[model samples]
Target: MSKTVVAVFSSRGRAEQAVSSLREAGFNKEISIAAKGEDHKGGRGNTDYFGATMAADAGDGLSDGVAAGGLLGGLAGLAVGAGALVVPGIGPLIAAGPIAGMLSGAATGGIAGGLVDWGIPEAEGRQYEEDVKQGRILVSVQASDNKADEAASILKSQGADRVKTH
Candidate 1:
């Protein structure tokens, strides 16, 4: 069986490092990240927010264009499908990998509701949502039961707070 491991980071830098370590440890595909987006409006009407924010391999930081909106550093490139979107009560959010899809469809539900689909308890999901709103970062890994511990360890080592598995 698979389990979802979630961790919260105080800063995006730490979150990026955690994700890089996870990728290096071979958790590439199942990892996802969600962070409070820049305090600006998302894509205009009909604009492709998801496609337009593809993270590029721009050395240490995001490429000029992607940085203006999406993730920072190579972390952007590390994510499979990065994008920006607006959730009803959560404002704009920058998300990548599997979570982006969930947020895209969570317009009415917000990040907490989207997390429930990942098997996180609703109360915990709400707490995570509040964390992001307060400028923290959320990193999650969907791994086999046997690998969940390792993933959690990686996250904890990279300075994650409130690391938990569900």
Candidate 2:
């Protein structure tokens, strides 16, 4: 069986560090990240995290495509499908990996709804959503039962808050 481990970070740097650590730990896939877009400041801008224009439709939102070469810091050059999504009530957000697609399709339901689909309890999902709205970053890793604890540990060692595996 496989399990999903999720955590929230108070800073983008910490989230990126967790991601890097996960990658170093042999987790090259099934990693997801979501953060309040750099342009999410009072919903006042058109640019995304990498300065890509936000699209009206979810299908086109990922127009930026592969983000391995665009992101900076610890997340730089990490091969993953990424883009900007305009979420209802949450404004614009920069999302990458599997959760990015979920957030795109979620629309009115937002992040919490997507997390529920990932097996996260509704109330916990809502709390995570609230944390993101408060400007934290969310990171999740889907791993086999044998590796679930390791994934969670990597995230926790990187300073992840509320690290939970479900």
- Per-model TM-score, in order, reads 0.80, 0.82
Regions of model 1 farther than 4 Å from truth = 40-74
State, as a TM-score between 0 and 1, how close model 2 is to the true structure. 0.82
Shift of residue 144 alpha carbon in model 1, Å: 0.5
Runs in model 2 deviating more than 4 A are 40-45, 49-60, 64-79
Q: Tens digits of per-residue lDDT for model 2 on 1-32? A: 87999999987678877888888889876898
For every candidate structure, what is the RMSD over all alpha carbons to the true structure, in angstroms? 7.1, 4.0
Per-residue alpha-carbon lDDT of candidate 1 for residues 1-166, written as tens digits (9 for 90 to 100) = 9999999988767888899999999998799988765543345322222234432322211122244453333554568877666666765566788887777776578888989898888999999999988888889999999999999999999999879999
Error of 2 at 154 (Å): 0.3
lDDT of each: 0.74, 0.74
In candidate 1, list every pair of residues with a backbone clash: none
- Estimate candidate 1's alpha-carbon lDDT, on a 0 to 1 scale: 0.74
